[model samples]
Structures are given as C-alpha cells and as structure tokens.
Target: MKFLLTSGGIMNKSIHDALVGMLGKPIADCNALCIPTAMYGHPWVGPGVKAWEFISGKEENPMVNLGWKSVGVLELTALPSIDENRWKPLIQETDVLLVSGGDALYLCHWMRQSGMADLLLSLNAVYVGMSAGSMVMAPNIGEYFVGWTPPDGSDVTLGLVDFSIFPHLDHEMLPGNTLAAAQRWASGMRGPAYAMDDQTAIKVIDGVVEVVSEGHWKLFKP
Candidate 1:
C-alpha cells in the first residue's frame, strides 16, 4: 500500500501533485472510499454535522471533495455486523481510501475490529490519511494526542510506518500546537518523528519516505 499522510487533507498543490503521482492517474479517473468512523469517536468532531460535511464534501478539509470518479462511505464501525465478502472486494477494487481525522486510538480500534488493519498490507490502493487518520499509522500517538482510548488502554497504533507524526503544527486554531509543544511531544516518542503544518504531507512508496510540503515541517531524531 502507498501512503499520502497529511496534517490536513490535500490542502496545497504540492500535496495534490504527490497524490496524483501516487495514483498514476488523474483524481477524476479513480474510485474512492471515505472512512468517517474516526469522527464519531472525537467529542469536538462529531457524530453529527461534521461527519456529514466530510462525507458530503462540504468540510474545509479536502478528502471527499476531490472530484473522484466515484466516492462512497466505508464506515468502519458498521463493518463488523456485515459479511466480509460484501466489503472486501469494494476495498480491493477501489483506487484509494480517504481516511478522515478524529481520535487516533478510536480509529485504530475500529480498523482492527473491522479487519481493515490486516487487509491493508495486501492492498494495492493508495491510502490518504488526514490528521488522526495519519497518526493511526504510527507505532504510538504519544499520550498528548490520546483522545479516545481503546479497551486495553494503550497509545499504540498500527505501526505501519517507522516514524510518528505531530500534525497541524502551529495552526492558528490550535494555539497550543506550537513547535515547542511538538518538541515536548517528540521527547516522549523516543523515535524518529515529524512536526508538520497543514500544507505538509509525508509520502511513502515502497518503503521510501519523502516530505512533500508547501509550508513548513521539521524532523526530530531520538
């Protein structure tokens, strides 16, 4: 699986270009599935209008609004009740998965429960993760970002990538998300990590990682 992990969605041209490059085709030619499960787990994000905005392409973040050939919702929370045969092929046939931001641990829980975590390794599709969606790929999200906790009460996640991410670095709305705060967060990570702004994205293809940014980002080493 290829990854285009963003602090925000494809917020800038560079990130958009990186996504298109990963797809090897125009956005209009590809089929996509937007996962909104994470939003429900977040208190500030929702089980309401915010989730609807994301799915309907009305959200400020650019995931579902990219004008793909087709866009469908793949709510992870609802997957466990249905037959795998019904959804597995939909995922395999889709060109990309647009995962939304919310609570990383909560998203991780559903991803595991829904069996999407296991299936991810075998898929050929590109994965576009926003905020917590991107964070869920790391080994751990660190204590600071833990919003919704899993039953086992671990900050650990999918570990799909070698490094952790500190997203939305210095955004105005998140006044507390300064570089200094990120430094403090990085110290606890005890591994390689990145602090990226909304305009930045980290692209991974065949195990090679590259920073695609129009804004600013910093890589911290442990």
Candidate 2:
C-alpha cells in the first residue's frame, strides 16, 4: 500500500506529482472514496470544525477538484447501517482512499468499529490523507498539540505506519501546534516522530518512507 500523508491536502505541484506518481494512472482515470469521519469529533464547534464543514459542503472537493474522475463519499460514521454488498464493491473498485483531517482519535475509533481500517489494507490502492487523516495512519499520536480527545480505551491509531506524525508545526491559526511545542512532545515520545507544516507530506511506499515538502519539516527521536 502507498500512503501520501500530508499536513494539509496537496498544496503544490511537487506534492501533486508525488500523488500522481503513486497513483500510477492518468489523473482523470483515478476513482476516489473519500472518508470524512474524523471531522466529526466536535461537529458544529470550534473554528477548525466549522471551516471543514464549509469545505465539505462545497460541490467540488479539493481532492477531486485536482482531476479525479469521480469521488464517492463513504461516511464511515454511517457504516453501521450501510449495506455491505453495496459499499464493499465501491471500496474494491476505487483507486484511492482519500481521508480528510479532523480528530485523529475520533477517526480511528469509527475506523475500527466499522472495520474500515481492516478493509483498507486488503486493497492495493493509494491512501491519500490530509491533516488528521495522516495522523490516524500512525501507531500513535503521542500528546500531539493538546485538547485532542482520547479514544474510549487507548490513544492508538491505525498503525499503517510505525512512526508517529505531527502535523501543523508552527501554524499561525493553531498556535499550540508550533515547532518548539512539537519538540517538547517529541522529547517525550517513546519512538520516532516527524513534525511538519501544512506544505509538507510523508510518503510511505511499502515500508520505505520519504519526506516531500514545499515548506518545512523535521524528524525527532527519543
């Protein structure tokens, strides 16, 4: 599986090329299944949450607007009531699983409960993640900025990657998510971690990892 985990969506030509390279097909031929469950953590609250709401409401999603022929929305929050026969085929036919950002813990919870996490690994597709989308693919997001709600039991993620990912380093709107603060969090992390600004992305193809950045990023070790 290939994962293009970005702090934000594809923000530049380099990032888009990295994505297209991984997709291995014409941009117009790529079919996407977008999962926006993470954005549900504090639905209807906070600046970030409200902003995401407006974006998703728009007819042309940023991901699809890039050139994908079609985007099928799979509200994982509604997974419990959906028909497997209908949705499973959609998953198999899709060329990409595009996950948007929100609350990492919330997304992971529904993913596990609804079996999305397991279903995804079985496919050979490009997993495009933005913000919290990138965070949920990690083993854990150890004390990331603060105020992130914990899961019912553990703070575990999808474990799609071994290392932790810290996004939005030094973001003006998110003052808590700064370089100095991320370093402090990294110092306490038990394993390796990477911190990135919105213009950066962590690409993992098979087991190899690469940093694709248009702005700034850093790696931290215990």
As a TM-score, model 1 comes out at 0.99
Which one is best on lDDT? 1
Cα distance off (Å), candidate 1, residue 53: 0.2
lDDT tens readout by residue for model 2, 29-113: 9888787777777443333644455235442225646767887788787877877787888888889988877788888888888
Q: Estimate each model's TM-score.
A: 0.99, 0.90
Report lDDT (CA) for all predictions: 0.95, 0.79
Weakest lDDT window of 10 consecutive positions for candidate 2: 52-61
Query: What local lDDT score does residue 105 receive in model 1, on the 0 to 100 scale?
Result: 95
Estimate the Cα RMSD of every predicted model relative to the unseen true structure: 0.6, 2.7
